[model samples]
Target: MLFKDQVDFVRQHIKKNKLRVFMTILAATMGCAFLIVLASIGFGIQDTMRKEILEDQVITEVEVYTNDGEALDISKISAVEHVNAIVQRTRMDVMTVSQLENRSLEGNMALTNFAEEQKSNLKLSEGRMPTKDNEIIVGYQFAENLLTDAERNQMEQNIEEEAEPIGGYKESLIGKTVTMSLQSYESDEAFPENWNFTIVGVTEKPAKDWIVDTNILLDDSWKDKFQEVYNASVEGENPDLFYSSSKIYTSSLEHVKSVTEELKGMGYSVYSVSEQLEQLDVFFMAFKIGLIFVGTIAVLIASIGIFNTMTMAVTERTREIGVMKAIGASPKLIQRLFLMESAWIGIIGTVLAVIISYVVSFLANWILPMIVGAALGEDSFEELSMTFSLIPWQLVVIASVISISVAMISGWRPARKATKIDVIQALRQEL
Candidate 1:
């Protein structure tokens, strides 16, 4: 038979059973739409979580500390297999004030040693990182306590009245004079009476407050002075030689586990975000599979509907099949004709589903952020940067293939029945 004639015959049947064919197409479309939407949600969640983990810290970093509460020695970690770099941060808990200011603004602060030898892993927003003892890099809330009570009150009033974004005050505090005092929050005595500092830089606003908080990065030369002052004040078995807690960066992500295990063997407790991320990958894989499985149930129901429709069409068109056979139509042609018809139904359904799913995804991604921003009020800057849905081209192709395959498979028995019809028996049917 001519390809044109085959196409014409399929078109006539589709036109004849408009309602039945249309219903089959609708079922397939609904199933494909549901599957795409669900898969999109799954992929979006995975992408967002992966981003948060990666941006949160270096993928190769492992945080290790001694079990005996002693300061970790860099020599020991450096000697560990797979250990690439060691950042020995000296953290001294102290109180700080914006020096040379008459209002006497003070806030809670901790100072950490910043060395040229190691990566700070801190994102800077303005100015340059402090390279000298007299300079400092500040963080979120660096200027919060520097504000006088009246200034604080007025800032709050502006936010309440005008809905200003949070942390708007930090940008203005750059280049201001700051002073470090070794006095604990409860004491009036400062180890260094009047050591002055200049605010050289500020960090990018972090997702978590603890990433910055009131912590300031100071020159590494001051670590010894801090240790001496801290020990004189508290009197421990040993002055903290190195930071009690240390961050160790491995050579690569693949080496994190090996380095962590090595640290544990050396009688140290170790932690890494990379370890949690590995588990996260597994969980998301399972989560996505579960979502697709549920969506596949809808596809399965749609396939069943298509199957029934095709079976009924065969019964109704038995006489037509017999007449075509008597007119010298081959069984293969009969089978090909039915498969082509079912494939057209599947393709039409897939196109409609693709259109509907992407439109909905676009609207969801655009609108959800707006709703969340409105709800956050003055703290909207802390809102997460994420879209609820994402539809990749991979999903589009996979859904199309799956839908058509299901339709062709479902129509198999019916197509074969059309091919095997006895001319005499089929011509006796009512239609």
Candidate 2:
């Protein structure tokens, strides 16, 4: 028989056994869907993790702190290869007046110049950066404490009316002046609560694992005011008027190592997430392996269905097979025909699986956010519901392997059984 004739015969057999074909196709579809969903979720999680590591330009920069007199010389450090620039700023955990307490609360605040560092890293949910010396931008938690401090101070002084809060939350601190106590670090005793600054901006709380809170972003003008305070304490002599740390930004791994060593020698501590970031790459590798393991089980079940259907088809066509052998048909030809039927089933299963997987991925994209929103509230869900992208190559490879292997295994036993049939016995049995 011609190859085309064998293919046509397999197609006819599948058409005749419509129910069996449907079941096998359904199995293949489910298997594809499983593989696709797992792959999508794995890649989605990796993307989200990458955002946390790379977005906002967080990982590209390293912050170096110095409390001792060991802070590096900025000019010497800048000469390192691939070191683009360094942003220098100081942070001190000082008291900000808590209006709720009417007394100063122990709060740590960051005093940074908004001009040097990238703005995106400092997330501004509302308001704008401080443009003047007296104005300051604070974190979400710090803003809340400032507002509470205002209310408490008002009550303490027998003042009945305080400014009406716009939305009844800490978010109302925008565009208002709040009191925070600034004292010199040299003084062991608490300084008077006299310093006050306007709330020009409110930034999102620092990242979850951030080191400081109740932070402040101040322009050059505010730094001058801090300088004045320090100078006064030191009897008009320069006492390093402003205390600051420097951050180096770079993309080259070689430069990172070199600069880190140089900075370390200059009495500065080197800080980066290089180790933690590498863990994410390891996680995705393991995840893809695990998904393939699960996919293998689905393929095994489909193989059994293929074997049973082929075996049954062989039994029903026993008399037809005997007549063919009586007409000088070779056993090899019969085996080839059975294998062709199995291959066709494999092809059908694979096509169905790919179609179903595409549909499922679309539905998941539409429905996942709604479900998350209902469970976690709209605001929280908004942050969590990022885009989902599919892995096409993974889908194609997995689907093809699963479908073809199942069919080949299923067709093998029936082909062997057909080869053992005696033409005389098969011809006399039923027909």
Candidate 3:
């Protein structure tokens, strides 16, 4: 028989038992949808984590660590191929008190090279880079945390009472000369000489909302002057024990791997965000495969329904099969018709399953964040970019192939049974 005739034959039989076919398709739909939605959780979480890592770190930046106690040679690192810039920061161990008018704040002080910082595209919220050794740049939250003694006391009291704390200094810190006093770590006594620096700029805010950037960045030229006071305060301490952190930036993200390898070859320990992402991808790939394996079990369970339905169809159409055989229809043609009907059921069910999966994914992504935020008693989570469920095209294709293949396999035994039906017994209505 022609393919069109075979299709018509299958359609007529399916129409005769509409309710049974509908239920079979429903089972298939539920199975396929479950698989997609279950595996989507893995995909969604992987995507969210990948995005967070990318946002929190500079992909092209490689952190260089010295293997020995010696400091990193900036000149040698800068000479490497594809190297864009190098930013080295030396943190002062002494307690630094920054005083602006009547308000003062104790914060971390780091000496850095302004030239290298400019090359690394260090962002500023206001004003320009420092042009003199006495000029410095502060973090975005520097002004906010610079509070007076009375305000600090009030803030402490409010914290104890679980009340909203008073605000900090509202005035702009740009072009302001701030007095910095280094205090001895062993004693509360301030050093005899105080260093005065002009605030030329405020660094850009951090990527995370919860991170407070209150660090102060001074010119490397002032490192010696600050070190002298720090060394004098701690007479027996070794200044060489203090290590500086150096970060190397590549011209582009594509060059990070090569640059990192070269730095490692030079006997320096290097870490890059790209390396972290590579590990993350490998982990998620295996995790997603496991989730898919678990989800396939649901589809297999649904296949049982397909098998039963097809078997019933063969039994019900035994007489019809005998009549077709008596009229010269081949066994293979009969089998093909049965298989086609099962495939049709799979096709319809898979299409519907994809639609349902997408709807569920959207709803989950939307509702889950709000639900979690409410449970945590924090509204900031609602603003976070998080994915709870995701369905990519590749997942849909995998599910379709699995669903349709299982349906065909389920119908195979029943289709073979139809081909072996005894024409004489079926025609006579006898065993």
Candidate 4:
């Protein structure tokens, strides 16, 4: 048969049974729309999660922490293939004070810029990282906390103690001297007020919540001062002094294994980012699976609609089928005709669904920003660009396959019934 003639015949059949055809198209359209929307949502969620996870630094770098032991042999770790550099970091909690105002501050203490030969992975979003001893760089959260009314009042009380109530110096403290004290942890209950530091730079807050709180950067040149201040706080008592720790980094998984081996040889425990990343992957997979399971139910309902519509179409076309068979149309030809009609419903419905879904995605992308901004107390949603990104090839294949499969399943029984119809009985049935 000619393609145009077959299409015309299909159109004529549909036109004669307008209600049935409309219902079939509606079912297919609903199914396709649901699938496309759910898939887009899944992709968006995964993309957002990945961006958040990798925001701070590259996940490829292994995070190593030090507890209590001999330092891992750098030479042995360096010998591992793909090993590039190792950076050691140490941290402690200390009292910070405004040197200009002489009031104690609250923050975590960090010492870095350790060895001149070592490469650093530390990044500064504002002022430079501290290179000199006593030159502190505060994160954004620290700066905001320092500016609060409670802290400002506490600083003023110190001024009252010294009889140097300098209101003029309050503004100067931003760029002026800030001191940090290194005190004994054991004697903290008896003599809690004894460590100090000098502040130099303040920068953007770290993205990770844990890293921003109680963070103060320092250098190694002030170890003597740290010890001296620590001793004074203990008042000749052999209280436990604050200790420092180091973290070593490697370039690759091979390097991490090498470093782990060397650390084991040195009688130390070690960990790597590979384990953390593997856990993260498992988490994402479970999350995606759960979403798909839920979304599948909605798609299943849509498929039921397809089945119902096809069944109705067969019942409505009983007379037409009987006439075709009476004219010597073979059962195979009759079955093919029903299948083609069902296929047409699937194809046209999917095309409509694709167009409608794009419109829906576009509107969501535009409106969601305003809603998010209001919820987050932000002026704009510039940070959160809600993308309506579709996996085009995957979507295309999924939609096409789903549409055709749904059509076939819905038409199967109807096609078989149409083929089995007795022409005499069908013609006699006016009802």
For candidate 3, write residues 275-375 as lDDT tens digits. 99899999999999998898889889989999999999999888888999999999999899889988998988899999999999999989889999999
Per the 3 Å backbone cut-off, how many clashing residue pairs does candidate 2 have?
8
Question: What RMSD, rounded to one decimal, does every model reach?
Answer: 4.3, 6.6, 2.6, 6.5
TM-scores, all candidates, are 0.80, 0.66, 0.91, 0.68
Cα lDDT computed for each candidate against the true fold: 0.77, 0.68, 0.89, 0.62
lDDT of 3 at 58: 75
Q: Is candidate 2 or candidate 3 better by TM-score?
A: 3
lDDT of 4 by residue, 21-60 (tens): 7776877787777777767776666666666665655444
| CA lDDT, candidate 1, residue 117 | 24
Off by over 4 Å in 2: 1-3, 38-59, 63-69, 72-82, 96-115, 118-181, 184-214, 219-228, 231-246, 251-274, 319-336, 358-383, 386-393, 416-429
Q: What does candidate 2 score on TM?
A: 0.66
Per-residue lDDT of 125-231 in model 1, one digit per residue for the tens?
Answer: 67777767788887655665456557667778888899653333444666777665666655776654556778877777776555646566677677666667667
Quick one: best TM-score, which candidate?
Answer: 3
lDDT of 2: 0.68
Q: After superposition, how far is residue 162 of candidate 2 from its true place, in Å?
A: 20
